[model samples]
Target: MTDHLNVVLHPLVQHKLTLMRKKDTSTGVFRQLLREISQLLAYEITVNLPMTSRTIETPMTEMEAPMLAGKKLALISILRAGNGLMDGVLELIPSARVGFVGLYRDEETLQPVQYYFKVPDSLKDRLVIAVDPMLATGNSSVAAIDLLKKAGATNIRFLCLLAAPEGVARMKEAHPDVPIVTAALDERLDEKGYIVPGLGDAGDRLFGTK
Candidate 1:
């Protein structure tokens, strides 16, 4: 597996991530911070998106300006926690097409079982960015990517708030070509399989649940 993880190690992201790590951070504060960090990371993740020049009338004269090239961009949220990250990215890329992948864990197998999955047409032609908040075991991330590929997404990128080494390795083995953009590359997962020194379940924190 290639050690090609594009972890965003910016100080601001680190500081906010630390604040988010604290158990005392309130829901409102946590949500706000996540959005802020996601926006900053989004800026870095989308740096290389293809652009095309288009003729437009400027304030003074007609001129050609660079705009996003090819089919409309697509944002495929891996449901629940992914939605939290989705909101911030959508604010930055407002016009990008949106899709959802809903998966629930199966108690017996400890595996991600897809409940729902849908995406826009021509995903292969568009630049598709898949969002999920946590890269815990990477089960769902891999599954989501598989579904996207089946739906015709060739050019793909994965965005997340936090990732564990185990998850990174799993993703590397599954899809080395896909670039993963994240705020932090955290320590290993603990006995229960949660990231060590990591913020607790992102879904619970984001939704005010157990």
Candidate 2:
């Protein structure tokens, strides 16, 4: 994966994402698919995590074993929709520290407005992976990253279920250092700022809201 973006096209991830994109899929099923797919995405994003070795005693004999190097990861959910992906990633990395960044879009300017923000301590020492289900307009995602940077987070990665060309370009321009990992990259954002061929409002669909 390049330092810019990594699109996970594994068969299982693609299959589940296809289900998520279908307009008729129910909320429960969509939630389940998101959880399953997030795990797969987690695997891809963490491929190069530093590793260390420790001596351990097995049932047979004492030997050196491999373990993750450095402090526990900080998983920063970008708000309500990010929670869907966060739960699944937490399942895989149960010991990870969790954080939240809440943002809502302004109807007038279509800009992101922060509502809440909290993150784990020593963000600079840990790998911070920001989770948001859909990278639609990239405003909120970029804003959340800004908060993280202000909080002293340097090592950061962005995880999303789907991304649009517009969103990717925006993120690349704003924070080229942070890599983006996603299941699929769609065509473009519609006039309303929703991803085209993208699953409808991720937060709304995940929570059965209008």
Candidate 3:
């Protein structure tokens, strides 16, 4: 195993993470926090994206300014909870193409069962950022990326609100080429397959369900 996974740790992200970790935080607060946090994390994740220079008039003369030059990025959300985080990231990158991956786990089989998936054409040429709110078992996240690769996504990055250590390791072993960006890495998963000390079921909190 690599000594460390390539994870982005930012200060604003840390503070927002602390707020989200609190048990008393309300649903409204939680949603807002997720949006703000996702935007900050998105900033960190997109820092290294390839850029090209363009000449623009600066009141008097045209000078070269670096700008994202290639195809608009692709934001693939892993359904429900991922959509919440996607809202914030989209606020930052408004022009990014959006996609959805819908997978429901089969209780008896203990495997991800894909229900729906749709992505933009020419994914191989665009920078793809696949996001979800939580990464617990890593099965669904890894599977989602596998589907993206199958659809010709060459440059891809995974982003999430929170992650467990096991999930991190799982992704590393299964998809080493894809770097992961998360707000916080929590403790181990509980017997029920939930991240310990996590913000509880992300979908539940986002949707106000049990």
Report the lDDT tens digits of candidate 3 across residue range 95-160: 999999998656565467898999999999999999998888888998999999999999999989
Task: Using lDDT, give the best candidate's number.
Answer: 2
RMSD of 1: 1.7
- Each model's backbone clash number: 0, 0, 0
Q: Against the true structure, what is every candidate's RMSD?
A: 1.7, 0.8, 1.9
Write one digit per residue (lDDT tens) for candidate 2, span 134-181. 898899899999999999999999999999988999999999999999
TM-score of every prediction relative to native: 0.95, 0.98, 0.94
Q: What residue runs in model 2 are displaced by over 4 Å at the alpha carbon?
A: none
Return the clash pairs for model 2, or none.
none
**On TM-score, who's better, 1 or 3?**
1
Q: Show model 1 residue runs off by greater than 4 Å.
A: 1-3
lDDT for 104 in candidate 1 is 68
Ten-residue region with minimum lDDT total, candidate 1: 1-10
- What digit string (tens of lDDT, one per residue) describes model 1 on residues 111-149? 799999889999989999999888988888999999999
Q: Which pairs clash in the backbone of model 1?
A: none
